[model samples]
Target: MSANPQWDISKALMVARFFHLLCGARDACVTPFLTLYLRQMGLIAPWVGILMGTKHLIATTWAPICSFLAKNYQKRQLLLIGSLLGSAAAGLLLTLISPLDKALVYRFCNGSSSLMLPINTTLEKELAPNHSAGIKNFTIRTKRSQVNSRVMMGKGNPQRSMFETTDSSLPLLHVGSELKTPGTLVNLSLAERTRAQDRSLALSLGEHWLFLLSMMAVMFWELLSAPLGPAAADSLYEYLDFVDATDCYRRLWVWKLLGMSIGVCSVPVLVVQLDCFLAEDTPRAAVHFYGYTAFSILALPVCFAIPIPNFKRREPGHKAIKALSLIGNDCLLFLLAVTVFLTGATVANIENFLFWQMQDQGSSELSMGLSVTLSLVGEILLHPFKAKILKNLSSLGTLGLGLGCLSGQLLYYSLLWNWWAIFPAQIFGAISNGALWWAVDALVEDLVIPGTERSLSVMLRGLFYGNGASLGSFIGGFVVLHYSLAVLYKTHCVVLSLWLVLFIAIQSKLPQHRKINYSKLLAVDTADASDSEEGAERDWLIKAMRDEHLTGRAKNKY
Candidate 1:
């Protein structure tokens, strides 16, 4: 096969963008609304937590298996199978199951269906053409689709109440003209070049596995919610199969956010409409299930129709190494994980607790929905400014700002008894959560070694996020049960404040460093080390050695 393969830009973008729309719609119908639906069914806080936790536990367990399949199989086929199975499971819950059976089927279906996320992202990256102009054109068309979806969905309040947190990691958009190419070096035999490529592939696969294992270990506490968005995004970039990474990511985000908005906004409308037609509560859920089923059915044909280009998979010749061997030595990654874990905890706490609090204060469904919509609108409006903010403040600095805002929002909620107080609080929450997520995304990309699996970093982040959220939800159920709402908010504030302090302390000690070029490592060049002594490769090696020594010292001091 030639080094550079040709792709149909128009077809690829259309498929990926449309697929995102479907997935978004599916998520809107289910994930965010599940909690509200359960609450409506008269389940208390603890039962809600337990059900959500069960789903997370099952999803986390299935992740490694899904990752393995993704690495080895035809991703498009896996996505199709997952979508069909998930839809069927949802159908069973909708049409056939009693209340007792609902939770089990929901958990199973949610986990099984989620497997499609990473596969879809990987396909999008693989199929997108590598030209700036093509990507720009694709983004323009995708935005129009998003606008149309939102308009058709209807807009009284911003559809924010049913905010389902999807994975935020997608392809990194590279806008620069000077794309990096392989380093110029002496010519090698055809056999040597093939071996080099094979070795590179094996090393990457091993790194990804190692990261996966680490995430699973660290995220064992995660028992609610799965973070699949970033993982999919990371996979898209990792394979190095797609062109114009940045443009691809932009299109993915636009379509995804749009779809989610539509899904979330539709729920209140569905509930109100269903209440009139069907006396039993089951009918509302059935409608949701049928909606997902219809979307899943439509998705399969679209998946098959997408003209995805085929790439040959290479078999690795070496055994995979331990996860720790590749990343255990990196101190920055550890800190990043801790931060991600805390962020997840705080976000989950806010998400789970706030809704219940609103209901307790006698807020109507429309009012609560409007609050959520406004919050989401705040988040969306703030997103475009993220790049500018990050440019001015370091990732850590931005994180601190987010944490501070979150702390203030919690404090406000704790003090105020009025329902309308949540409006300004939503604005604060948006800036806080949005900024924190954006910083974490950029930090993960920056900290990862260029040649290794970027998806692993994302997965690891997801693990932390999931772990924190699960623990938070479990503990939150008890906290809200045992204590006042004021106490819950105060507790969150204290925890975040502590994390902020630790973060600042850690940031103060970290070194200001140059970018490490891992092109040699990525190339897997078989040539002797001496041949590559004249350029950035030599400098990179020296910096890596120095960093390793410093890391050893830091470990001893701790």
Candidate 2:
């Protein structure tokens, strides 16, 4: 146990916080604009689709590189160097457009930056601890188990929720029966599952790396910039030891490397190709491009101000807040899953709907870019309100508001035909995204110990995001290929509605810790205690050594 209970923010944390902020800003700048950039470069839609697919492939393996780097370099230094390298590459790419230059920059920024994913994961995991000694390790292990269990169950059912079917025993028998009864219908064994998983991961590696680099830079900047309260560090050291440096680094690397697989499989391809909706060199096209970037940039700082309860550090006034937050977390995750699914499908089908809208409006590529830019502008406009909403409402309330707005946006999209009408939806998207992201970060940070494990929490977040995005993208592609865009959009509306209902239903059951004096318990106040303990221990050791020396002299004289 640490002699002092309070946590002090370290230099590494400062480095990480700044990096995360940069990542968020970068994501806002890049992701929504990449497809249009591809169009600018004269790539056709099919190649664009291939590039979109490849982004996820790179994202999925991002963590392994972090792990490998951690083995040889200081984590903080590596992050700094990575960012510098990526930034330089991005700048160079803006000026230089040859295939070779694009490839090099893309590999440096997008390909290698995946390494940071695991580092972030480890940081989040290290942050969630209390005063109890060894509590963090135990909690991390438990959290891992729970996450694995949920994933396994999710994989097994594929059609049902884990909560719906409490029976875990039936899947094995069902699998076994399938194996016995059929040739083509046979269930896969563990070996086959591993093989399939490997193949899926392997398939993502070959897409255009440059575009992925842009998106990766943007997202990572967002993550790096979000603020870290003192509670994060205090809680982390309470449970984890950094002394066994190799083990510490290794543990941090494990999930992130694995998490990259999640990213490679997650990006929504249709979203990347949204530029096809307009002809080249028009105001609307520029609007689309700028609007997306603007929204992302505005969303990050606003999200930092949103106040979700830190359930990990118990507060005094909000006794029931913890319980409410737990229910809220579950609800939020459910909604988020649905949101990802629907959004992905909509993005995939957007080209279908926009093709007509573009024809009707005679929208050019510049117009299309402008439309994207306008959406981003609208999103930017709404970012400021996020802090206020979070502070005044319960965490769940804030989430509900965001989701409600998001639902309205979807409905608006469904009812309207004008490309200009998308402004309202984009504005709402900014708020929705800010609030939703803050809610998730707060929820996870609350659940875990704060210090060293905070990174793990972040990593897990990436995992969930990567998983949802990959699956959503994959499903969206199939839906667009087979169904009309209208069908896809309407289907998304239905999923969002279902998500809301599930959140309402399941929100009462999860565990929550009321607001407590978490800061008091965390190691913030350790200045006095640590000094006193060290002084006393040093004095005692010195006296003991003196007594031993005196005894040796007396015995020799006799």
Candidate 3:
């Protein structure tokens, strides 16, 4: 894709909005429904679990690699566009994977027992001419069983005793005495049964193979596009610099929420309708696939129109070392890490258990999904005010408020008596998840070592959303198994309350400082950077080491 020649902020922002929305819609088209699609395709629970986990693992593994590539290269837009198109192409290939219909096209394709009904078999000499009709009925039953094999859940009858009639009631001459005389008729039927079973087994294996290959290819393409959200943030920052506009990086992500809300909220209803009309019991995943393909293709053009202004990038290793030093030196990083970890854990529990709790309170999945719309709207509402919040409370202060609000929400959940009660509680998402997100991003932006923007962004994204969520989910699974939602939520509320107090106590004890000059971190030369960011970092490092030494940890390392 070619970059647009006209690239004003107003024009670029519109393009950026469309790109983000399309990205969100594309994601909604496939990801959330993929497990259900697999189930409908006759995959069992264990296989579904493995496939979904594999997709997550791929995202976790490739995210950092993609970030590195984005950081090291120019023409990031080109990489972005390629990934978009590649994923679309991969999705389009799914149209070729519709369920296989016939099995016996092996003995004449070489061929069910009778339906095991009470119908009596007769000797060839005594049988009526209409015996062929009975055989035809058996063939119909066998084909119906084949249909069930592709049906959702796809459960089949358990094996029956040999006395049961097989559905392969064809070639009527030796129907009854064939067992006694094993002639050409019996051999043909037996061979047909064998071939049919083999064909069914082969088809099953092929579908599984196709699923594995399709998932891998799609995930591989997505790996290249993983840096998009972070890159968008970096681009926004650069644009702010270019236009001499005030930086409000925290608010920018509201667009993401808006787009995602539109996608996640609306698509499921359409998908339900599609599933109902397209196949009686089977889901129509082809729509999801082709829909994803279309959205990605649509976004490809938007990428060209969106401007991603580049700075004179710093040395890669130099930026990396800068990040390392910041981590080692800044106490704020520790606080940020622990907070985001807990935030991720809290989010995980909510995602995994909130709906379960709601269902127990008589909520439908429909209500559960619609409730998310309210939560997202709250988050978006809060995002724009982050600048004011940060101004009033500072990063740690804003974070403290977030923790307090989160605990409050948990308390409300503990007391929830009805499904509808969650609506009010979830509206507090603005203060809890949204505020915490903004606070964390604000601090990260403030602490960012200039040219390390994309690198740092991607790294922390993986930390909070990936590592923290993984650990949270692992722990939450056990917690939920033993405890009721009320008990679990109340316990979490207590824990968060303690955490908030500890956070405040530490914030008071730690050496606090004013915000660093943003421009200094962006310096192209080391000497220019050394004057401000380096000096501040040195002072902060000394304070941290002294503090750690007093605590008898890392005493000799410095």
**Clash totals for all models, in order?**
8, 117, 16
Model 3 spans > 4 angstroms off: 1-6, 29-57, 70-75, 89-225, 231-251, 274-277, 284-291, 308-321, 352-366, 391-394, 410-418, 444-458, 474-495, 516-558
Scored by lDDT, model 3 comes in at: 0.56
State TM-scores per candidate: 0.65, 0.43, 0.62
Specify the highest-TM-score model's number.
1
Query: Scored by CA lDDT, what does every candidate get?
Result: 0.54, 0.39, 0.56
Report the lDDT tens digits of candidate 3 across residue range 269-380: 6554442225432234456676677777777778766676655754444554565466667776766767766776676556545654553344443465578778888877
Q: Which tens-of-lDDT digit does each residue in 1-558 have in candidate 2? A: 243234233433333344334433334344544544443333323444444444443454454344323323424333434433443343333323322112222211211222111221011112122222132223233333354456546457332233233221110101122222324233446675454444333322322453455445434532232212112222233223332222332233223222222222222222333432233222122333343334334334433422212223322333224433433444344444444444443444343234333322233333444455454444445556656766787567766666666666556655656546654566666666556655555554444434423343433344444444445445544443354334545676677667767776666553333322245446454454435666766554454556656755653554
Q: Write the per-residue lDDT of candidate 1 for residues 301-417, one digit (tens) a residue.
A: 665554433357644412113223334555666776677777676677677657556644444444666677677667888888988999999787898888899889888888866
Q: How far does residue 540 in candidate 2 sit from its true spot (Å)?
A: 36
Clashing pairs in 1: 130-243, 158-373, 160-372, 160-373, 167-229, 169-230, 173-246, 222-467
Q: Hey, what RMSD does candidate 2 come out at?
A: 23.5
- The residue ranges of model 2 lying beyond 4 angstroms of the native Cα positions read 1-30, 36-53, 63-68, 75-361, 364-384, 414-416, 445-457, 511-515, 520-558
lDDT of 3 at 400: 82
Question: Could you give the candidate ranking by TM-score, starting with the highest?
Answer: 1, 3, 2
The CA-based lDDT of model 1 is what?
A: 0.54
